[model samples]
Target: MSSVTSSSVSLPQGFIPVMLTPFLESGEVDYDGLKALTDLYLEAGAAGLFANCLSSEMYELSAEERLKVTKTVVAHTAGRVPVVATGTFGGPVVEQAQFVKRIYDTGVQAVIVITGLLAEEDDSDEIFIRRTKELISLTEDIPLGFYECPVPYKRLISSEVLAELLPSNRIIYHKDTCLDIEEVVRRIQVAEGYRFGLYDAYMVNAVASLNAGAAGLSCIQGNIYPELIVWICENYNNVERQEEVKLLQKFFVDSMDIVHSAYPIIAKYCLQKRGFPISTYTRREVGELTGNLQERADQLLEDVDRIQTELGIASVFRKTLEVPLK
Candidate 1:
């Protein structure tokens, strides 16, 4: 087991990509493909990696596969950047706590619990608080985080819950998808005295979030254009580049439909075009990429290429042929 203490560990504060799991045409986890994917994210200068996330098709993966995949990412990263994995979804609090312990054993910096898993749809704040507190108590010493996974149902936390939990210093990371700038600002204010980091997944409001003291971004857009995402985070505060950043943000908003309509399939296709050793096969029922979708992806790539050329960023796509991981 790793001797590093979880509480002392601080997650990197930049573009942490919610990675997609690679699958072979035969519908098996492609280890080599996964290694290459990890390398690609690192090469794009990702601050950290979020594995076994919704983008990774975690619901379809068996418990063993989730553990194996998380371990593989930790092994490949080799301490270059911290890795956080989704450790629990729907289960009894004890079972979920046990799962968190198992994931912690894999050497991840933090384990994320999907917010919807903590209580039933009609449960009150008191129930949610009790369950969360119990899970934290059960998984002592392991750093815990929360993801508002929109699947099943999106249970966004209330400010009252944040006020209750932040003081305990147990929840160190939160992937906020609320998309309300005012609410994000309010939460940041409420969390001022705590050590927790808030990462906004809503790209449309990412710059504003960072401006309002969000620690960083965790988004699927990073899966296709990690370098560009990193560039935004690195330059969002530059006075001279404020206009340019706003324009870039506008571009992202305008192009969201083209890139996100097909989701992981389109994301995989982007990777395939970028020379990763993976297929566009997804466990989700999203059908094959039709010609129209392919054309849209191509157009998006063209826009990306133009932006890269203008910004002097060497394209991450098809630029390197070797899959560095053996």
Candidate 2:
């Protein structure tokens, strides 16, 4: 119940960025770059941070490194906003539960459970549910969330599962990657009236999902321009801004491929172009941003500037880009 514990479980509204881990050219974790990146997201109106998630290359990071990454984010944030992180890597329930406690000890409001890690592709829901229950029980009363991580495989949780788990109250957040608005609505319905929220990861139907009563967005689109995502969340229902809102929604849909080409590399490149102190060097073997993809990224940068100007939002990377929150 302390400020650093359960209280942080109530993640704020608007964009909650799935943070990218910054690395030096030699591939060491660049703590300084990570801090600067954190500043950029906050300045762009991020309501919270999803550190140590897939975007942070959690798979490549060792146990100590994962804790270090999560701890770095927690310490740098200084409680400005809530932070959540993926706790369950692929392993036995008890082993995953132990890391959950360690991640929780890093002062995260909630430790996220990756759905794919809980059971195999061929595993039955009953099996997944049983293992999930075991993981929850072993973690005691610490808060938990689920990420529909598309690694190993994209193992989704049905609304039935939500109903089964909601009574526990320990599950407070969900990063929904199902990509179907109807499915998103179903999950939201099940989560209503609890201290729970479903953050949509798909940007194509973001407007529909938000108006359908989703808590907010947690998506890759935010990695490119966090402020724009914040703007959409703040103005999604504003009658006068409907035109602007629709324009940006279309941008999210159209720009998805270009922005996602090389993943955090493309995103990092976009930031570097804006003069941020980040490198495009990524630990993941995502191909380089060259040829057609590189061309699109360049064009996308131009489009981003144009859209930001028309939308009347400033780029978080201002001239000097010294940190301040939206």
Among these predictions, the greatest lDDT belongs to: 2
lDDT of 2 by residue, 1-326 (tens): 33444434567778899999988888889998888788888898898899998888889898999999999998999989888999998778999999899998898889999999999999999989899999988987888999999897999999988888888777888999998999888998988878888899999989998999888999987887788899998999999999999999999999888877889788887777776777777888878788787778879888989999998998878647533211
- Per-residue error for 71 in candidate 2, Å, reads 0.4
Candidate 1 matches the true fold with a TM-score of 0.95
Backbone clashes for every candidate come to 0, 0
Q: Which lDDT value does model 2 have at 88?
A: 90
For residue 26, what is the lDDT in candidate 2? Answer: 88
Candidate 1 residue 204 C-alpha distance from true site, Å: 0.6
Q: For residues 85-176, write the lDDT of model 1, one tens digit per residue.
A: 99986779999999998998998989998999999888998999999999988988788888989987898886678888776577778999
For model 2, name the residue pairs that clash: none
Which whole-number lDDT from 0 to 100 does residue 218 have in model 2? Answer: 96
Q: Clash number for model 2?
A: 0
How does model 2 fare in lDDT?
A: 0.86
Candidate 2 has its poorest 10 consecutive residues by lDDT at 1-10
**Deviating ranges (above 4 Å) for candidate 1:** 320-326
